[model samples]
Target: MNAINSQKKHVFFRRVSTAGQDIITQEAADLPFREKLSDDEILIINEIATSANKKAIKERPEMQRLISLVKDKKVHSIYAFDRSRLFRDFYEGMEFNDLRAKYDVQVIYTSVGNGNMPASDDVFVEGLLSMFSDIEGKNIARRSREARLRYPAKKFGYQKQKETKRFLHDSSKSKGVQQYFAALKEISSLDDLYKVTKEYRKKLKKTDEQLVSMATDPFYAGYDLEKGTNKLQHVTPYISIEEFLQLQRVNGEFFKAFLERKKSLMCQNIYTPCCGYCRKPLFYKIEEESNSSYYSCSSKLHPKVTVSFSDLSKIIGGILSEIIQNFNAEKLINQSINCYRTIKKHLEAEMDSIDQNLNGIIEELVLGSDDYSADWKQDPMYKRKQLLKQEYHNCLEQIKENQNALQKNKSVIKVIEEALINQSNMNPSMLCDMLINGIWIYGDNLQVDVFYFDYLQEMEKEMIFEGEDIA
Candidate 1:
């Protein structure tokens, strides 16, 4: 659709990847775009407490609505705090890119500054984010996992070892399991088995299914895999291994078997020539109806453009690993510290300048020999003095704010340094933010920008200007 075919209004969409993240941070950053919107001119879509990390853009309801609007050419320009908020999936990026291109929609990231764009315009971020989710989830999961390990799973007849994550026999529950299994073999009448299992179910507070599963489980026969940990090599079996195997051999002998059971780079080190035809970045996506990471370029201008390597994900993974290794865990942390130090020095200089200005204002307040004492309250000098005093108060408040920010930065720096030094585990998002500039696609080759630091200084300036709370 052409410009005449679409509405000339902006859509302000802000979202957090996880529920724990505060959207207010995004709000503070996008004030420049937000303030300009007339009520009818700007459509505000708040996806607060929503996670683009967990749900694809297609799965998100608000996003789906916005997509529909975009499809209808009802939107003119789309404004978001970061591209990450819009998409983290490769295909989702392609999907959105196609829509944006086809409909003539402009995508603007308001938070990008000093000519620095968001690291991942669309694709690599999803995986790296998934990898971060991989990081955060594992750490957090291990904590919860440890807590659960302290007790047995709701499974009958076993308790977990706190430290080793091993299951120990709970005699009371195990007795019920043993009784049910023994009955399963000895009892001939179906009705008799029903009564026995029902009584055991009530006594154990387990359903019939649980009792049957226990009997069928090799755990009762001394071995079975629980989850990710390990299988039981030794156990007080309710029956022998032979019996467990025999039960499985006969289809009708045991209950029916039942079973049940989702990563971009973009700009600074990232560079993309505007598709002059479109705004989407290097697209690495999979074919539909499949859950594979196949690479493809979304550039219509170069329809034949294709990634030259196999397993682009692996290549990206290797790149990420190498980046982390080259930095030696200390490099990124040190760079971050230096950036904050630069900011601190700038703030200190600002405070000193304000102090000097206040001092001059005070000197101006002192009366000259020609001044009349009675005119102090009635003359222009009085007005000037009041203004000077207001200025002094404002300067003091600014110093206090800058001082508070510095203090916060110090505490954060300590925590960051300690985390980097002790755990030695680097967060993927930080690596992407502080280092991976962008992944730009040229006509035939894909470029990965590994060192992007100019924006860090720009970021410091933004923090000062916007009063961003680092803590």
Candidate 2:
């Protein structure tokens, strides 16, 4: 007992990919202690210190914790029932070897009882085990992908038949799916569909990409993901194949138009401007029959308030004309440039500080002396590190925004000067993009706010117009 105490390590690390009832009976929790450690060794039983999931990814938090423990000399050795429990890939195996060499940490496979240092034969055996596990994982993924092609899995509007395990249309959720697809067919754009199905959006909360993917999914039309001309009409379909094809075409056009319009100035500010009554940003939609664009509030309480794009242009044009006549354009441009430079300098300095702090934290982590407590999630330094990362990204975004604003202001000055010189031929779209910040509509009244590039005071001028009299 005294000799065992002298030889036994301070800490023993144990890991298993599975811990619940599914684990093989022979490789249970007690087996590791029985086979691997002597009576004097102690196991590290902390939840954060162990990984028990099927995922063999190296980026897992549990794996990181274990690595940290080894690097910090908190654990002298790691014990697993099998080599696969530790790693299943050659890259990870190589990484472990490097860690072992640098830190003198022993990795023991209890089932085989290989000693302190893995000999040349033990290294070869470990490599083979990792290679086989990797191959098995890949084979499982390939089989699963093939199975999906043969017997496609149930999707949004489907359920499996209990008796046969085949997919069928679920009556309970089919109504909503039908209505959604039907609405997609009628609407010209996602913006129009979103306005029409505001209540449904509240329930589903699907993004534009999700909506598009759902609408275009071939499974609704009784087709598989595999490339085949013949339709698989075995199971029940919620939507007709013909209708589904038509919706796909319509969705294609909607996306193409959306992409084109997103490049325009009005689309950029459409969601930024808010409704005075409900404080919800206005959404833009195009009329199918009249081919005219209109902006309306997203709030259900104020659905009647809407303004035409042309009317908005006219109202905003008058404001810009007033500004051109009253303000000195050259002086404003120079002031904006100077203001942008000052803000940019400040943001860059803050970014440098954040980078320096982040580097310090990373260096500490590399040296295995990070002051971050074991409860890293709750540690103040860990929280500060996360905050610094977020701030760094935000600062980058602000710098980009500032650069864009400076370029836009310069463009505005050039366009305004040209418009003043040749008043007959002015591009309203260009002017709108350059000067107008946002527009708010309330009942029949509209407020247009223009951006002033001067640094001295609040750089915005608001003009009110009655919508009924605009035309």
How many residue pairs clash in each candidate at the backbone level? Answer: 10, 0
Model 1 bad stretches (over 4 Å): 1-7, 16-21, 48-58, 110-471
What's model 1's overall lDDT? 0.57
Cα-based lDDT for every prediction: 0.57, 0.64
Top of the candidates by lDDT:
2
Q: Tens digit of lDDT per residue, candidate 1, span 198-316?
A: 67878788765676666666666655434543435534456787777766665234254221101111111122222222435545443211323333456456545444223333344
By summed lDDT, the worst window of 10 consecutive residues in model 1 runs over 259-268
Off by over 4 Å in 2: 1-21, 24-26, 29-40, 44-59, 81-84, 88-90, 110-154, 183-208, 226-234, 240-250, 253-471
lDDT of 2: 0.64
Worst 10 residues of 2 by lDDT: 45-54
Residue 229 displacement in candidate 2 (angstroms): 6.0
